[model samples]
Target: MHVPDGFIDAPTSAVAGVVAAGALAVSLRGARRELDERTAPLAGLVAAFIFAVQMLNFPVAAGTSGHLLGGALAAILVGPYTGVLCVSVVLLMQGVLFADGGLTALGVNITDMAVTTTVVAYAVFRALLSVLPRRRRAVTVASFVAALVSVPAAACVFTLVYAIGGTTDVPIGKVATAMIGVHVLIGVGEAVITALTVSAVVAVRPDLVHGARGLRQRLKLRVDGELVDVPAAAEPVAARTSRRTLWVTGLVTSLVLAGFVSFYASSSPDGLEKVAHDKGIDAGARPHTASGSPLAGYGVKDVADARLSGGLAGVIGVGVTVVAGSTVFWAVRRRRGTDVSPASTAGTGV
Candidate 1:
């Protein structure tokens, strides 16, 4: 959930910001091992896609809706480390441009949404992969379960954060109960989206799916009434398209989703908004900084038309998120490419 400003104290928010920044720093290093020539290019697309889907909120409860949190989908499609960076990039773009989340509460959002979800989802995914059969189905199943749990885990984590540094004098127990209860229903939507997206990716390019890596099972045979291990079969190469083609395709898909499809999304308030209203935690909510901007509130600044304004804002947001996310991922990929350069190695030897 995108926690607004005034919910948490400045010191706690600052601490969260530091924690998120540190985690991002570590993820940058870990991403080097995860992203290669094949996957690095897709990483940017993943971020853009996440940004797109997050805009289309679906109905959950009577008045509450939920959007795709995307931690599980990103982690399984890309890798955990890269997934963290992807969601963070989207959050940053939404905050600084779309004003979807508050700038002052950026750290809180990152800690609860990016860090906590990614960590829990990936951990659950890895554990599931270890026990489940090493097949594409297992990956999808794990994605579903991981996404389902991640949302509630994040809700719990946010409740804990508010308990520690809540601006209001609300009871922690009530907050926790409300938060978890509402978010659990939201988790079902998360699971469905995560599973479907992961399944789609795995079907097209299983090789690009980090969680599906090394999934080809070893051969087994019965010899002398005992089971014996045979050599694992060589996995077939995926029909992966070129990075340029994938990027273009991904950006096009994101544009289609946000620029057009988002118009049909439910108008109901999301889980967090509903819970905040019910629990009175939203009493001190501050106005968004970008409220005065023309593009604030997901509408175009002077576009008198509702559909046109919303469509334009959505288009701009997708374009901006793609550009920003692609830039960040491309830089990380370029630096990684340079780090393993032959010329640098030759110089080192000399």
Candidate 2:
């Protein structure tokens, strides 16, 4: 959930900002090892897709809606470090451009949404993958389970944050129960979206999926009396297509979802909004600082047509997030290459 300004006191938000900054620093280094030629470009597209999908809020419970958090999907497709960065990019874009989340609560949103969900979901996904059969279907199943658990885990962590720095007087127990209950329903939607997205990518290009790496079925050979494990077969070179096709497909899909399909999203309040109203969590909420911007509230200013205004805002958001995310990842990848060149030269005495 995107915590609004004033929900948490200044000191706690500052602490959270420090924590988020530290995590981002560490993730940058880790991502250098994860981003490669095949996956680096897709990372930006993944972020843009997550932004678009988030705009399509699906109805969950009575008067409540939910959307894809994208942590699990991103982690499964790209690396966990990059996944965190991807979601952080989307949150930053939304806050600065559309005023969806508050500027002061950026750290809270990043900690609760980006860091917690990615870390928890990836951990669970790896653990399940270790125990389950190594197959495409198994990857999808693990993605589903990991996403389901991550949402509630983030919700619980948010409750803890509130208990420490809440600006309201509501009972912590009530808040916890309501947050967890509604988020559980939201988790199902998250799981379904994560599984489907992971499955689609894996089906088309398993090599591009970070979690699916080294997941091929092991070969078996007959020994003295029983079968023994052997190395897997090498993939055929002709089976692979240039990455341009995949990139174009993803971009088109994102454009369709945000430019058109988003118009049909439910108008009901999301899980967090409903809970905040019912549990008094928004008692101290302050107006977003960007409320006066032309594109504030996800509608273009001076645009009379509701559909056109919202559609333009969504498209712009997707475009901006993609460009920002891609620039960040490309720089990281180039730096990694630069770092490796020196080591190779030293090793070769060149």
Candidate 3:
């Protein structure tokens, strides 16, 4: 959920800012281990795709809609640390460029949407994987459950945060109930989106799906009544799709989703916005600082045609998010290389 400014007081927001910064710092380091030549670029595409899919809000209830939070999808496709960074990048772009999320509440949004969702979803995903059959379908199943849980988890976290620093006097219990209740319905949408997206990628390039890695069972051959592992070379190699092809395909899909398909998305308020309006949580909400930006509210300034303006804004958002995410991930990948370089380690005895 994109928490707007003034929903939380300055002190609580400041603390959240510190927490967000620390989490991001740790994720940056952890991402080095997750990103490599094959997946770094993919991670960027994941972020852009998340940004695109989020624009296509689906109706959840009479007045509430839901969109992809992306944490579960990202974590399943990439890794959790990188997933956090991916969603955070989308949040940053939305806040500064689209004026959707408030700048002052950036930390709150990141903590609630990015950090909490990624942590909870990834935990659930791995736990399920441990017990479920190690197959592609199992991975998709885990993704669905993980995504389903993650949305309510985020709602709970937001409720907790609001209880501590809420500007209004709304009863905490009521807020929690309403928030969780509505988001539970929203979670279904999240689960479907996450599962379908993960399943599609796993089908095309299981190697590219980080969570699905190592899912293939080893070949067993019985010789003299004893089972032996098959030689690696003896195994038939599956036809491979090039990473560039997948990347291009994903980018094109994102463009199509955001640039055109987004026009048909439900226009009703999202889960958080609906809850806030219903519960008087927005009584203290302040205008976004970037509200005056040309791309504010996901539309180009002075654009006569609604379709063209929104399309342009969506396309621009995808382009910027992909570039920014790619730059960050590539730099992290480079840093990883530098850290293991022989020249850098030559002077220091291991």
By lDDT, the best candidate is 3
List, residue by residue over 130-176, the lDDT tens digit for candidate 1.
99988778988999999999999999999988988888888989999
RMSD of each: 3.2, 2.4, 2.6
What's the lDDT of the predicted structure labeled candidate 1?
Answer: 0.86
The residue ranges of model 3 lying beyond 4 angstroms of the native Cα positions read 217-238, 341-350
Off by over 4 Å in 1: 217-235, 240-245, 341-350
| Lowest lDDT 10-residue stretch of candidate 3 | 232-241
What is the TM-score of candidate 1?
Answer: 0.91
lDDT, model 2, position 61:
92
- Counting clashing residue pairs in each candidate, in order, gives 0, 0, 0
User: What TM-score, computed on C-alpha atoms, does each candidate reach?
Assistant: 0.91, 0.94, 0.94
lDDT of 2 by residue, 1-350 (tens): 78889898888888888998888898899999999987899999999999999999999999999888888888889989999999999999999988888788899889989999999999999999999998878999999999999999999988998999999998999999999999999999999999998888877788889999878655577999999877555444225656888888998899889988999999888888899999989999999999898999888999999999989998998899899999999999998988886657786867
What does candidate 3's lDDT look like per residue over 1-350, in tens digits?
A: 78999889888898899999999999999999999999999999999999999999999889789898999998889999999999999999999999988798899999999999999999999999999988778999999999999999999999999999999999999999999999999999999999999988887788778899888545789999999988757754334777889899999999999999998999999989998999999999998999999999999999989999999999999999999999999999999998897876887995
